[model samples]
Structure formats: C-alpha cells, structure tokens
Target: MLTCVTRGLFIQLVFDCRRLRKMQPQQPGYSSSRAYLELIADLPWQKVSEERELDLRAAKESLDRDHYGLTKVKQRIIEYLAVRKLKPDARGPVLCFVGPPGVGKTSLATSIAKALNRKFIRISLGGVKDEADIRGHRRTYIGSMPGRLIDGLKRVSVNNPVMLLDEIDKTGSDVRGDPASALLEVLDPEQNKTFNDHYLNVPFDLSKVVFVATANRMQPIPPALLDRMEVIELPGYTPEEKLKIAMKHLLPRVLEQHGLSSAYLQIPEAVVKLIIERYTREAGVRNLERNLAALARAAAVKVAELDSTLRLGKEMQPITTTLLDSRLADGGEVEMEVIPMGQDISNTYENPSPMIVDEAMLEKVLGPPRFDDREAADRVSSPGVSVGLVWTSFGGEVQFVEATAMAGKGDLHLTGQLGDVIKESAQLALTWVRARSADLNLSPTSDINILESRDIHIHFPAGAVPKDGPSAGVTLVTSLVSLFSNRKVRADTAMTGEMTLRGLVLPVGGVKDKVLAAHRYGIKRVILPERNLKDLAEIPAPILAGIEILLVKRIEEVLGHAFENGFPLRLHSSL
Candidate 1:
C-alpha cells in the first residue's frame, strides 16, 4: 500500500511541474525569469492616496483658480467627489464634457487631477479605429503590446490616475472591430475590476482609475458607450463670458508668452468686446486667443522698436544735440537740446501713451470681419427668402431658405444637399398649403390647379453643406406662403420649429443653441414653438433681453409673426 501511494504522488508532482512551466510568462531566449519578476514588482499599484474630505476643498480651490466660468460644471464635479467620499467602494462616474473645441474640456480633466492629488494621463481617441488600440493585441501576434488604458497606467506608475479619453466621437470603426465597443468594458465599473488584457492574459484591477471623455458632437458617439457616461454640456460662452475669459485667463497667458506686460500693452474691455463680436465668432476663445496673440505679436514688435530706438538715442545723445540745432536753424533755435528717437521735436516724450487696440486697430490686426451679418441680413430681405436657425457641431448658425415660383408641371425642386428629414419637411409644407388653399385664399382656382400651373424651386443658400432636421418645417412653410402670396418675410425675424400635416407646431431640440444663433445674427424677433418657451430659461439673460421671442402653437401664428403684414388673403364670394 505505501509503495502504491508513493508512485501516485510522484506522478502528480510531474504533472504539476508541466502545468507551472506552461503558465510561466513567455520571454526572449537567454532572458532570466528574474527580469520578468522585477518588471512585475516595478509595476505601480497605489500611487495616489485614498480620497479624503480635505481633498474636496482643495479640488474646488484648484478648479476655480485654473478655470473661469463653468460654475455648474464645477458644482457637479464637487458633488461627484462628495459622493465618492461617502461611497468608497463605488467607482467614479465617467464624466464626458460635450462642447466645441478649445473650451477647456481637456484642461478641466487636468484640473480635476490636481484637485484630487492624482497623476493625469490623456489618450486621444480621434481617428482610433482598431479594437486592439483599446483592449490590446494578443501576444501571439508580432509587435504585440498592451492597450492605451494599460499603457497609460504603466506610464503613470499607478493603478489609479485620472485618464482623459479625448475626442471620443471622432473614433472610427472598420473590419478590425470597434474601439468604442472595447471601451464599454473598460469604462464599465463592474467589468473593469477584472479587466483582462490580451497580452497580459491576467486580470488587472482598473476599478480605481478615473476616466473622463470629451467630444464636440454627441450624435457621433456610440449610444452604448455614451450610456456609461454622465454627460455634462459646456455651451459656447456668451459675449460677456467670453470677455471675462479673455481678461481673466487668455489675456495674461498671451501677454506673458509674447514677453510683454499689461503696463506696456493695454487692451481695454471695449477692444476685447469688439474682437469678440467681429474678428472671432466662435463658441470658445481659441480664435480669440489667436487674435490676441497676433495683437500681442504686433505690440511686441512696436515695443522692441521703441526699446531699440531708446538704446540708439542714448548712444547718440551728443550727436542728437548737434542734429537738433541744425534742424531747428530754420525755426530760430532758442537752445541746443537732445531728444530721444521715440519722441519728435515736441516735449511729449516724457509720458508716452499706451498703444490702444480700438476698432481701427482690430481691423488692421485681423483685417475685415470674417463674418458679416449685414450681408446675411440683406439676403433675406426679398420675398420667398426666410431666415432659419440651425445648430451645428461648431455652434449655432443662421441658414437662409429661399424659394421661387416659375411656370412648369408643378414639380418641387430642392437644391440643397438636404437629408431625408428636411426633404420630407418641405413636402409636408407644400401638402399643408395645398390642403388649406381655400382658407389661405392662395388663389381663385383650386389648390391643385395653382400648384400644377407653376413649378416651385426651393434652395438652401449653402448647397455644399448637408442640411437636415425637421426643425425648419415652420420656416419652410412660411417661405412657401411668402412666395405664393407675394409678401416679404420680416427681415428681422428668424424661426425654428417642427410642423405637422395638421399645421400644429411642435417643439424641437437645441432651443438654446438656436436662440443663440439668432442672437448672433442680430435677429430682433424670434418665432419658437410654445413648448420651447421653457427652454428659454436656460438661455443667458442678456441674450434673451435683446430679442423678442414670440411663442406660437400653430403654423398660422408663425406666419403672423414671420411676415410684416401676416399672410395676404383674397376675399371669396362665399365669405
């Protein structure tokens, strides 16, 4: 019995050793196991300390100090931290800041890291297509390596760092598999605890790491991936906010970079406002910053010239007296004096005036305004042309809807690269007008006869840009009405809303964005759906104060507000 037991034990021991050898990490020939062991030991585990109450206070201070505005975002982040402190076991919510480029989305992540006392790592997801980029390639493949998440952790030397995944919406997909789908696992709190990388082939804890994402447009982001994140919207700054940002953050940074000071170069608030309104019409201060840098560069050149002239003047002080005497000979010289090159013959050299960047200086520095609202306004002054508000990924813009009638087989032609939704909207508008021809007094003949007599051509000004969405329904209807009735749309009016076959106006999304776009174009009166009146509360008070908002529940109301003298109607014998 003892001999049999000994044999069995020997066999078991051999089997165990074979399994152990197979499980060992693969390495190049002639490399010792000690190197691999050292690498594992070198991997950083807990680089950041546990979240503490005091860190929250520090975080708020850091955020406020580094960033301007975004009060709501700051409060939301603080609330997140407070929740994290209360629930230590829970993973942090993945925050995705949606806004235009250069709006401090990436910078805010860095600020969050500084607040929490953690290392920061950023991975640009722009154009990242392969799934291997997120989950890592298998070691079986040559040139195999870990994914960005793992690499970021390795570089930071910590398991828990603030990782910012930027431009998530820009990620592409192909046969290689979707990187966005792979991110779902990494971003999920439940699955990330045992996150198994292909190369590592072992579970690595990623639950402690905090991930933040950013994107310019939300629609391009995969719905499944967006679901895992708590979205925070950062709208384009208002004129006042932009000015404050320029004065508080952008001005100082640009001035220091150009080696100039406020004492030497003075940019008044009025000049900043002019730059904001004319030179740059963006949601963020990126263009504004660039313009300021240009101004700074121009100012730097002047300063350098002034400095060089002063140096030259000091060197030629003795010669200056002789030159002044000779030059003053024609004017009857009373005394021999030396004047600086920066100063003329007058004594105005003692107190030099600061270079003021006014409207004229702005025009000189930035050339003419890139965006001319007057041209846009003039385009909509004629009949059959109406102003429509559109929300783009960059920001809000005013789109012109133009229509004209000609004698043909009643075919409706749409010239713009309009999508299915907008094409359908245009058709619906025509249908509603034809059905209600008697009520509208469109013509003495039947509605079908009127449409059959002439062909209508509708064109959106910018045919190159793809336009879609149902929000332009009201605008299209108003445009068609104005075309048939020979009435001009009010030049100061802009409209946005969806319309049903029954002439009922429906509310649309991006109300704030649309309103801001109208405000940017200097529209005095805006026609919006009655339901969207609630959304107006979110708009800036200053923007709302300037424009007249007419809330309408039906298409008739829109027509009333759109035209200077409502829709012209011809009296019928039945009336």
Candidate 2:
C-alpha cells in the first residue's frame, strides 16, 4: 500500500511542478508586466519635481515665451476654466476650436494640455466613417479592438488626458453608419461616465478626459453633436499676427532644424514680414512655418552644393537677407537686397550663398494668393449693380447683386444657388416693390403692366457654395428696386440687414465679420443694422479705421446710402 501511495504522490508532484512553471510568468513581478512597467519608466512620463505640474500662470508665461500676441485667446482659456469650475461636474465640457488650418489650433490645444495638469493626446478623425471607430468593434469571429478613445486611454495609462479630436467636422459618414452618432454617447455628460466598450464588454469611466475638437467649418458639424461642445473661434491670423509669430518662434526653431544656428544665419525682420504677407496667406502661421522650412531646406541644399567649392576656399561667410535675395535672384545675378551674415573673410566659391527668399521667389514657392479682395477695387461705377455684404462660413463677403428688366413673361427668373430663405427674400422684395410702385410715380398702369410682365434674374456668385440666411433681404430689395428704377448704387458702399414687409431693417448677426469683408472690398461706407452698433468695439481697429460705418434704423437709410441721387421712388417729385 505504501509503494502504491508513493507512486501516486510522485505522479501528482510532477503534474503540480508543470502547473507552477506555467503560473510563474503570470505573476505580478514576472517578465511580461515588468516589461510594460519598464516601458512606462523609459518614457518622459516622469521629470524632476522642479519641472513638474505647471500652474496656469506659469503656462501662460511659457506660452508668452513663444507667441507674441493672441492675448484674447489666452484670456478666453482662463475664462473657460473659471466657468467650468462652476458647472455641476468637475470635468469640463469639450471645446471645439474652429478656424482655418495653421492658425495655432493644435498648438493651442497642446498649450492648454500643458497648462492644466494633464496628459495630451490628439486623435485625427478626418476620414473616420465607421461607428466602430468610436465604439469598439465587437469581438467575435476575428481580432477586434477597442475604440480610439479606449486605445488612447490605454496609451496614457490615465483616465484624464486632454484629448484633441482633430478635424471632427471633416469626418465622413456613409452606409457604415455615422461614426459621429457613436460619439454622442461619449461626448454626452451623463452617459459618458459608464461608457462601455464592445470588445471589453466593460463600462469605463471616460468622464475624466478633457475633450477638444477642431474644425475648419462649424456648419458641417452635426447639430446634435455640436450642442455638446462649447465652441471657440480661432480666426485666421492677420498679416501682423503672422509677422509677430514668425519673428518670435518659427524662425529660430526652423534655423536650428536645418542645422543652421542663429550665430550662422540672420533672417531679417523685413524678410520675416515679407514671408508673412507674401509667402503665407493663411489666417494661421502653419503655411508660414512650411515656407520657412522649405527656405531652410533650400539653403541647406545650396550650402551642400557649394560645400566642395567652400573647401577649396578659405572661410565660411554668413548669409544675410540681401545675400539671400542676390543668390536667389531670378536674373541669375546677385542683387544688393541680399547680403552675407558670416564674419568677413576672403571666400572662394563656385556659387553665391543662397537667398533668404525674395518676394518674387516667394510667389514661385508658395504660389499666388488663394483669395483677392481686389474685386472690391475692380469697379468704380455701376448703373444698377451694388455690393451687398453677405455672411459666409469663412467670414463676410461682398456680393454684387444686379437687377435688369428684360422683355419676357412677367415671371421673375432667379439664378444663383440660393436656398429657401433667400428665395423667399427675393419674393418678399418683389411684393414690397409692387406695393410702392405707384408711390415712385412709375409709368402709371402701363409701366406696372410692363414691370409685372418683365422677368428679373438675380444671381449670387460662387454658385458651387450653397447660400442661405435672411440677412440678404435688404440687398435683394435694393438690387431689384435699382434694377427696375434704373438708379445706380453707391460704388464704394456695402450693406447687410433683413427687411420686414413693413420696411424696418432688422438687426443682423455676423456684423463684425461682415464689416471686415466690406472693408476688404475697399468699401468706404457700410450700412449695418443700428442694433449692432453696440458690438462695434469687437471689430478690429484697423478695419473700422478705413471704413465709414453707418448704422440704419430704417431701410430708408440703406436706400439713402445705396444711391448717389436717391431711390427713384424716394426721388419722385411733386411736379
């Protein structure tokens, strides 16, 4: 019996030893988890206590370390956090930063992440169309994984990372189902706490995450989704802003990035400003950054091309803006605008030092301006055509609305991709004009018959873009009235407001952008809603300085500003 028992015990012991060998790898301090731990260690996850969590004040100081202006944006961030603190939840709502690309949206996000005591992660959602992208794909037949949010959570190994959803509006939707719909649950305050992943089949608290989204156009955003976000507008940087950014941060970094230090190269302020206004035409400094990068690359390439020649010569000469211009001169001969930046020495070389990029060279590199406000300057006179200030997704634009009476059926013809509201506006204008036709002392009943039978075609340019909104009513009325009356609209003026059938000019929104657009068009006079006058302080001083802004309480003022003499109806005499 003892021998039999010993044999059984020996067999069990061999089995137990095999199990122990397998279990060793699963231990807390074992190799696999330890490997993950080591990975966390090697990363820049930890720093000296001295450089630890920066307060908002310190972060602001550091931000000033780079960007010179954008004080408003800095103030806005502080205000946002203050408002968030008073909210019911500790976590703040998502902030959607809307603006043209390159105006520092991503950088600002990074800055905010640093300002707050949080980790940062940016997930680009440009072409994300699948619902599975935001909500984890179910794990069944094949290898499935968690959504981007969950994956990002795993990456930072923390619940609260400042997550930037880049290009949220640009994300696509098709038969796969709108990925945006899945995000509704994630973005919603109440439901996000118990957000469940399909693969994990476990509820994860994502509420701690500070979410941010960026977009070029705010309109394309799903209305339901947009409601969850607190939007911040990052307007395109002005020429001055770009100039400041280039001088403060971009030029120095790009110099070192190309293996050229400040001691070796001197990029002039005029050269920087030239690049901002000429080479980069964005509301942001991103393109400025790209061109700067390109210029550096070109310089490096030339430096290499001339390297062999330099070896045969004596000393290296620093490149100046003038030297740069001369080297890159289109005529093939160096111009005086370019100069050398290095210590003066006898230098022998086959080729001159490359340019810092001249105005002409900038055109070749960055191409011509994508837009022109010159249309505003194109014409000085119009018989009936007038500049109507219209608001758009980009900003305010001055639209030319022309009206003419043609021999056709009394049916009114309208062109331009106008929406339902705009079409109604056109109709409303006709009604208002028809009622006042007799007051204008028209060709009596005979002219009224001709006017009724005549067809009027209205059009808005850039037909590819869909146009809507009721603010163009006053312009439509002025155009139609001018067309019928053969009166001229003021060439230097532009106007925007909604007109009620009662002839009251209702105040309109987007007043600031509209005024800027008008100013861009070289408009010396602007007819805006009187109620909007209170908002004038928001308009930039540079724009308001050049233009004569007139607020109107009635459509009478609009008509007064539009015509040199007056609307024919108003000009009617008591002879």
Identify the leading candidate in terms of lDDT: 1
Task: Give residue 304's error in model 2 in angstroms.
Answer: 4.7
Candidate 1 positional error at 301, Å: 2.1
Write candidate 1's Cα lDDT for 1-575 as tens digits. Answer: 12322466446545545554666456452133333233344556445555445477778888888878788899999998788767856677899999877778999999887767778999999999999998888766766777888777877887888899999999999999999999999999989887877755556778888899999889889899999999998877778888999999999999999998887788999998888877777777899999999999999999888888776765774345776767688776466477667866545234356777878888888898876568556887778999998777777778899999999989999988989999999999998888767667776655345687789999998788888889999999989988887788988999999999988999997887778777777788999999998898879899989999999998888988887767655444222
> How high is each candidate's TM-score?
0.84, 0.74
Candidate 1 residues lying further than 4 Å off, grouped into runs, are 1-42, 49-52, 55-58, 308-353, 445-447, 568-575
CA-RMSD of model 2: 11.9
TM-score of 1: 0.84
Q: In candidate 2, residue 162 scores what lDDT?
A: 82
- The deviation in Å at residue 337 for candidate 2 is 38
lDDT of each: 0.82, 0.70
Question: Please, what are the lDDT tens digits per residue for candidate 2 over residues 1-575?
Answer: 12312466446545545655566775743453333333323322222112243355676686777556667777878766555445524667688888666667788888777776678899989999988888877755255566888787767776677899999997888987798888899899799987877754446677767888888778778999999998887655555566677887898889888987554455678877766544444445677788788777766776765666667455557647876676678557543564567745454333454355666665675577544546554542555476787766565667777667777777777777888998898888877777666655445642355365567777777678888888988888887767766676777888889989877899887776677656545579988888888878877687677889888887667877788876545444332
